[model samples]
Target: MTRLVAANRVISTDGKEIKPGVVELDGERVVNVSALLGERPFTEWLGGTINLQYYADEQLCAYKDGKML
Candidate 1:
């Protein structure tokens, strides 16, 4: 299902904030992020978590036995 996440400011590709932003999310992934334009209103969940994930990553910095193997 699709959902909406509104906020005062949202992150942009240029590393800036966009006022009145609405982030469209598909499940736990972000599908779209754009400014709230015109009179398009949302009729879905306001704010909530959708299966968040968190794990450690050591790709380039992976070390074995205190040395790069």
Candidate 2:
């Protein structure tokens, strides 16, 4: 199924903080992503993160191993 994820913050692999963003997922794969209000580019900002954490509406979700956590 497809879902929309809203992230408040993300910690990159290089230990950088990524601003909030919205990610569109099909099951566990990222189909599209964009930064939230007052944030940077999602693709560029999430470049080094092992795990992507975001909010699916109100619930917190993690993306890893091609699946949602």
Candidate 3:
């Protein structure tokens, strides 16, 4: 199954803070990390995954089908 992790801020492996980034995952594997400049909303990066973890303001929140899990 595919999973997604979106955060208002992501601390990169290189020790950089990626503000408002999105990470894509496939099962237990990471597929992509997006922190580009765009006109996209958080909903746009959202995929059809029942398992999603979102972090905002240093708080971790999980969502299942758009509802808190």
Q: How do all models score by TM-score?
A: 0.52, 0.43, 0.46
Backbone clash total for model 1 is 0
**Whole-model lDDT, model 1:** 0.46
Model 3 spans with C-alpha error above 4 angstroms: 36-69
Cα-based lDDT for every prediction: 0.46, 0.51, 0.51
For candidate 1, the C-alpha RMSD (Å) to the true structure equals 12.1
TM-score for candidate 2, please give it: 0.43
lDDT of 1 at 8: 54
Candidate maximizing TM-score = 1
- Estimate, for each residue in 1-69, the C-alpha lDDT of model 3 and write its tens digit: 555566565444445666676665554444566674555443345433333344455434444365653
Clashing pairs in 2: none
Q: Please give the clash total of every predicted structure, in order.
A: 0, 0, 0
Ranking by TM-score: 1, 3, 2
> What's the alpha carbon RMSD for model 3?
8.9
| Runs of candidate 1 exceeding 4 Å displacement | 43-69
